[model samples]
Target: MKILYWNCCGVGNPATVREFRQLLVANVPDIVFLCETKINSNRFQRIRSICRMEGCLAVDSVGKSGGFALLWRDGIDVSVQNYSNSHINSLVRLENEDVLRFTGFYGQTASRSRQQAWDILRRVHHKVNEGWIVGGDFNAILNLSEKEGGRSKPKVLMEEFCNILEELKLTDIKPCNGWFTWTNNREGDRLVKERLDRFVASDVILDKFPFLASYVVRQSRSDHEAILIDTKGSKPNRERMGHKAWFRYDTCWAGEQELKDLISCIWEKEESNMLAKMDMTRDKLGPWQFSRFRNLKYKIKGLEKEIIRLMDGRTDD
Candidate 1:
């Protein structure tokens, strides 16, 4: 199943609402996590109602500026793993039996407390099981690769961030598309983009489910782009290529003309019997046969399309 994680910046704004709806429509993710909701439960309820229409159940922490939230599509078995008193963090257990730990951190803009937050993250990582995933707007860059203009400059904050990663034994799941996930709020030439949002997995988790595909999505209003990840298999290419075969439909027969004649004759005999015979045919058909049957269905569907095209002229009159 596909899962999406994003920081909406704030669902309170109309622009963010529009972008959120568009993303839900485009991706159709089974699970969605949001950071920096910037609204408490009562105010968030309205946004939750909109998301419910997309078949997602919204769970959130109370906060005014930076709150964490967990949302999942309906009919999937999920539950809250736990939540801290601080709106900075929350956790949820997904249907796949994997735990998702989210920390909606807005680290101290310019203070030693950033290091303390990183240390808390290290502790949280240690407390969680090996299969869990920890992610959010880290606020502090992990390494030089995360920053562009400041690449050459030494960043003490980033150094402390790196130490936390090492201590927790967590590694980044690099994005396949975008290099950076956040941008500075400034006009024109003064703006800078940096990779601040992140997805980290333990060594054991990566080894077990290697086919994880991670990438960043572009949304105009928010400073941060959304991160998307899928951890269903070990090899993405192989699994993606093979998935079509798993759902292929075909039909088997001694003679194509004979089968057509038989179906037509059975329909003339009795509509009920015709459906029964079709069911029997379906039951007898192997995977290859089912695939062939689907091809024939498409051929008939093509004829129906042409018929509709011809009928369109009469409707115009």
Candidate 2:
């Protein structure tokens, strides 16, 4: 299952929403965490429709600042565990067989005060136990190499950031590809860049799911790049609903031995009737297959919604 996370700054804007829709339609990530949405529950439906991720749960702040949300695609079976109503700290326990916990964050960027923010993260980490992923803009680099500079660190936030990582025993997943996710929009030699965005996972996550990949995509409008993670090789529970083909197309129809003869039979009846005959063939086969696919898709979607709703106790049923 592929999961993506990004601090869009504010998805409430129309242009940002349009760009997001394009990326989501192309990539089709299983789960996505959007940070700095700057939107509350009042405008979440706009985000849901624009992104097209059905059956999602969003934890929005009161105003247009420090909001974070977690969303999953329709078919995936994930149950949200122990989600409180805090704006900066949005935590969810995923009900995979391994009992995974995912916490989405938007840390404080201002100096000195970030310490309290990190403290809160550590508290949440210990409270949630091990097997979890902590991802977001920490606003503090974990190391000296994280920031672009010729001299020493500004306020030496690395030591504090590293201490947090050590305490939590979380591994930085996007070190290789993404050096700097956030950049200053200044011109000339005064340009500044920092690796503010991050995805850190516990020892259990590394040991259990080693094949999961992570990277950052370029954000067009926003200064922060979109972070994407692909959770490959993780075993999804198939026994819950049993296995069935997601989509089926007739291979037999592609290579009919007497294809010319079939067309000849239709053409002999009437020249104008040739197109109508092919249309008839499609009409007969297409609806059955398409309808079945749609029905199965809707059923899986409903099941996922039910699971999430039951776990979170927010059923409209």
Candidate 3:
């Protein structure tokens, strides 16, 4: 299953609506979650028809801002449990009888109301028994590394955000293509970028779909990039068939001590030819990175099982 989430800023403009349709055609996501729609339920009916989605639940925008909508194609069993301005919580049953919960979330843009957003998340979390996946524009970053060229984010706010994720046992799925998901679209010194949008999933969901991954699609009309969660993983780029894929370094890997150690180990192998050493390192890095991701998934699965066991025991009391 593939899910796409975007904070489209506003879809009232004809150009913006066209761009949205293009995205729908390109990604062909099974479900789409939209934030900051800036339209009422009546207006959203036009959008639903344009997208050709058969199922829809919309939270109308107040005056000029902060609307949300969740749309799914026909034959996808989606039952909405509850929704407010901040979130839409739903249960999805696949054709194979596997069930999962999905929450389309939008965090409060104001600092003071952010706590309220987290509270809503907690309430939704309490009701979910099956695997869960939450995605949308959170309006906040988990850490300092997520933002660039901005005044430092408040440490307390970041800590609170991290604490809630830990309490809920939700793990952020790192994006495969980019570091930042939102940019201020300013020139030179005024430019600011942050990963304000993401998808977080319970360990059960991650374990069940080991190939699952998140990707950032380039922005067309909005400040935020669209986030795509692919349950089956990314497909090979057919355009690049038989050609070597370009190797671009991800700056995020620089902070990983394991990467440093891996480089050291590769260099220590006694090959005097520098070119050969570089080739060998590239070959080894791919498998090493894959193993690290696999290991983390396994660890999450074990932790989730233990937590479930303890919760069950408590419920019996």
Q: Candidate 1 — worst ten consecutive residues by lDDT sum?
A: 308-317
CA lDDT of each prediction against the hidden true structure = 0.63, 0.67, 0.85
TM-score against truth, every candidate: 0.65, 0.67, 0.74
**Which scores greater on lDDT, model 1 or model 2?**
2
Ranking by TM-score: 3, 2, 1
| Ranking of all predicted structures according to lDDT, beginning with the best and ending with the worst | 3, 2, 1
Candidate 3 regions off by >4 Å? 234-317
List candidate 2 segments past 4 Å from native: 62-64, 81-96, 111-113, 149-152, 233-317
lDDT string, candidate 3, 238-271, tens digits: 6643212323356777898988998898788785
Write down the TM-score for model 3: 0.74
Clashes per model (N, Cα, C within 3 A): 10, 2, 0
Instruction: Please state the error at residue 112 of candidate 1 in Å.
Output: 4.3
In angstroms, the error of model 2 at 8 is 0.8
lDDT string for model 1 (196-255, tens) is 787777787677667876867777788888888777623545542432343434254546
TM-score of 2: 0.67
**TM-score winner among the candidates?**
3
Candidate 1, TM-score vs. the true structure? 0.65
